[model samples]
Target: MTVSITDVARAAGVSTSTVSRALRGRPGVSDEVRAQIATVAAQLGYTASRSASSLASGRTFTIGVIAPYIGRWFFGTVLDAAEKVFSAAGYDVLLYNLGTPETRKRFFTRLPVRKRVDAVLSLLIPDEEEAAALRSLEVPLASTVGGAREGFTVVGIDDHAGAASAVRHLVNLGHRRIGMISGASEPLHWTTPLARRRAYLDVLADAGIEHDPKLEADGGYTVEGGEQAMTELLAASRPPTAVFAQSDEMAMGALRALRRHRLRVPDDVSVVGFDDHELAEVIGLTTVAQPVTGQGAEAARLLLEQLDAPDAEPPGHVQMPIRLILRETTAPPSPRGPQ
Candidate 1:
């Protein structure tokens, strides 16, 4: 026979309702009583039915995670770290990958995740329409790798600051003609690409460097895109002496492009990238390193806290720190090169 809640309650000398509250992690019971009830339930091999518990507590014991592309290094790392935290807390994860425009449209239109999770975690910033749809669900929401929305808690690094730091490094190395390979033009409200680009331009202006539109290229945050963008920049009448790629993958692509064109790195053009991917050290690529895993874990923790106490104070934003990693990829522009 299956062990029931009644049996556990009788063994622990508590009412069935008290056992239910304690087991569900609700607030009507003392810590000592809850611990005793858990111990008794474990000893008796008693497990509450999820359906019945959901009906009683109005919670699904699950979290819904939404991301653009999980295959990318940053997204993959963040999702993995967040999943570990949710699993340890006995919560299930439901992932939604909106990698294409069609999928994004379908997801926002249908909102299939409604009422299926205790909370939602977004790894990317949602557009206005998407944000509205998410808010309609009325669930606790949080984000990582994006700016704070009106109703959602956010955990991420300062994109503008990171970009500014990269530019400053290049400037300190005597690079005046700097170029940038930025993300593709989509998800205009995502803010990462926009903020970074704005900061890059601002830093150049402040440093008294002429900002040349011809030096900018769209890399789409990928290796192949970076290579293509770098090639285009090299073909320009006046190529920049230093190139800052928004991501490490793109930076690697720039290196390949330079080689293909018979242009030596640093010797011909210096390179810097953001998001210190695992290969950065192996390739000696200079980059801005942010706490990718830490941001995910912290976002998960914040959402869990909100779920635990919905009536608690409003959740605040978390800004993780970033640093510039110096490597062999960046140096003073060689005098032998045309400046």
Candidate 2:
């Protein structure tokens, strides 16, 4: 026979209402009584039905996680870390993948999450329309890898600082003619690409180097895109002595492109990338490392805090740190290169 709440209540010598409050971790139950009730429930193998619990508490105990692309290493890592936290807290995760503009439009128009989840964690920076739609849902929301908005909490690394750090590393290595491989300029709502590109320009200006638009190419933040962009940069009349890719994946592609052209890393061309991906160590990619997984966990925690106390003060922004990791991919510019 399946054990029920009544059995737990009888065993703990407490009323059903008291047992319910204790199990839900709500107030109005003494500590001793709550402990006794919990012990009795566990011993009796009693498990509350989630459906019933939701009906009573008006909480689904589910979190909706939205990401632009789940296949990407950063997004996958964040989702995995966030899942662990929510699962341990007796909450389920519902994933929504918005990989294309069409899918994003459908998701926002449908607004399928209504009454299905207690909170939301968005991995992408929403545009104005997307932001308005999210607010229409009236659910507690938080974001990772995005900028802070008026009503939503955000957890992310300093994109501008990360980009500046990459450029600084190249400049310090005596590289005057530097190039950049960045994400495509489309999807203007995504702030990371814009922030990083702006920082790269500012850093170059600060180093007394005139910015050359010809030395920059959009790599689309992919290995293939990086390869194509690197090819274009190398074809320039006066190519850069070093290149900074916005992502390690792009950097890896840049490495491939250089090899194809019979160029040696740190010899013919020094390279740097952002986000210390797992393969960075194996390939010796110099990059700016950020806490990708930790950001996800933090986003989950913030959402849960809001769920626990719906009337609490508005959530604030959280900015994580990033550091440059020295590796073999970067060195002083070769003397033979153009000064």
Q: What is the Cα-based TM-score of model 2?
A: 0.93
lDDT of 2 at 252: 93
Clashing pairs in model 1?
A: none
Best by lDDT: 2
Cα lDDT tens digits, model 2, 247-324, are 998999999999999999989899999999989999999999999889999989888888878899856799988999
How would you encode candidate 1's per-residue C-alpha lDDT over 46-156 as one tens digit per residue? Answer: 988888887877889899999988988888999999999998777899999988889888988999899898899997778888898998998889998677677899999
Q: Whose TM-score is greatest here?
A: 2
Model 2: weakest 10-residue lDDT segment is 184-193
Question: How does model 1 fare in lDDT?
Answer: 0.90
Candidate 1: list runs displaced more than 4 Å: 5-48
> Candidate 1's error at 265, in angstroms?
3.2
- List candidate 2 stretches off by more than 4 Å: 13-40, 186-188
